[model samples]
Target: MFKEFKNFIMTGNVIDLAVAVILAGAVGLVVNGFVSDIMMPIVGHFAGGLDFADMKIVLDEAVVAADGTVTKPENAVMYGKWVNAIINLITVGFVLFMIVKAYNKTKTPPAPAAPAGPSDNDLLTEIRDLLKK
Candidate 1:
């Protein structure tokens, strides 16, 4: 059972999956950074300096005591962060699509199959002619 488990862990598919997962996580971080650091600033500038991450709907206002102490609210909808996430997803998807398209374009088509060898009857006929000579 230990040997079987070791073989399973050493398989090519398992290694490939591990690499894929790591690369996917790295790509997600890059996409998130691109959305947050680059795209959002430009978008915010155009939309009157609106920050998407701060865009939210407050269901209930915070309660403040007489001495300025405040209690956190229980209900709220955070849509700004959702918008940023959506942007990241779109950017990552487009990049992946482009990469796949370029890869497909570079692949060489399979060469045409070689013509079949001469039939047995054709060889036999040649031998028969040679014998007659």
Candidate 2:
């Protein structure tokens, strides 16, 4: 069982999968950074300083007692965060798509197969024609 596990771990597919997973994690970090740090700010500027993270529908306003000691927290649906998440998802997908496209471009296409030689039947027909001539 130990040997079997070792063999499984040493397999090319397993190694490739491990590498792919690591690369995907790295790419995820890069994509997330790009979306949040770079893209969001630009988008916010374009959208008239609209901050998605702060966009929410307040269901219940916060209740405050005397001296603001006892208070009930606000309850609401935070749709702004959802919008940001959606943007993040789209950015990640687009970035992955571009990476795949670039990787495909780098790969060399398989060379075309050499043309096949004439068949035996064709050779025999030619021989027969030559004999007749």
Candidate 3:
């Protein structure tokens, strides 16, 4: 069982899958950063300076005591954060799609196999007939 487990872990497919998962995680981080740090600011500038991360509906206002101590609210609709997440998802999807598209574009089909040459027997027969003639 130990050997079997070792073999499974050492298989090419498993290694490839591990590498793919790592790359995917890295890509997600990059996409998330690009969306949140770069794109969101530009979008905010255009959308009347609205910050998507701060957009929320207060279902219940926080309770404040007389001494300015506050209690956390029980519920709220954080629609702005949702919007930001949606934007991040869309951007990541688009980026991945473009990457796949570009990769496909650059890939060339395998060249067609060269036509088969005459067999040795056929060549030998032709030589014999030519010699007889």
Best-fitting candidate, measured by lDDT?
Answer: 3
* Per-residue C-alpha lDDT of model 2 across residues 47-116, encoded as one tens digit per residue: 9998888999999988888898658988999999999899989988998899999999999999999999
Model 3 lDDT per residue over 1-133, tens place: 9999999999999999999899999999999999999999999999999999988888888887789888764477999999999999999899999999999999999999999999999999999999999
Question: What overall lDDT goes with each candidate model?
Answer: 0.91, 0.93, 0.94
Alpha-carbon RMSD, candidate 2: 3.4
Between prediction 1 and prediction 2, the one with superior lDDT is 2
| The 10-residue segment with the lowest total lDDT in model 3 | 67-76
Residues 1-133 of candidate 1 have per-residue lDDT tens digits of: 9999999999999999999899889988888888899999999999999999999998988887789888765467999999988888899999889878999999999999999999999999999999999
Q: Is candidate 1 or 3 superior in lDDT?
A: 3
What C-alpha lDDT, on a 0 to 100 scale, does residue 58 get in candidate 1?
A: 87
Superposed model 2: Cα runs more than 4 Å off: 118-133
List candidate 1 segments past 4 Å from native: 118-133
TM-score of each: 0.79, 0.78, 0.79
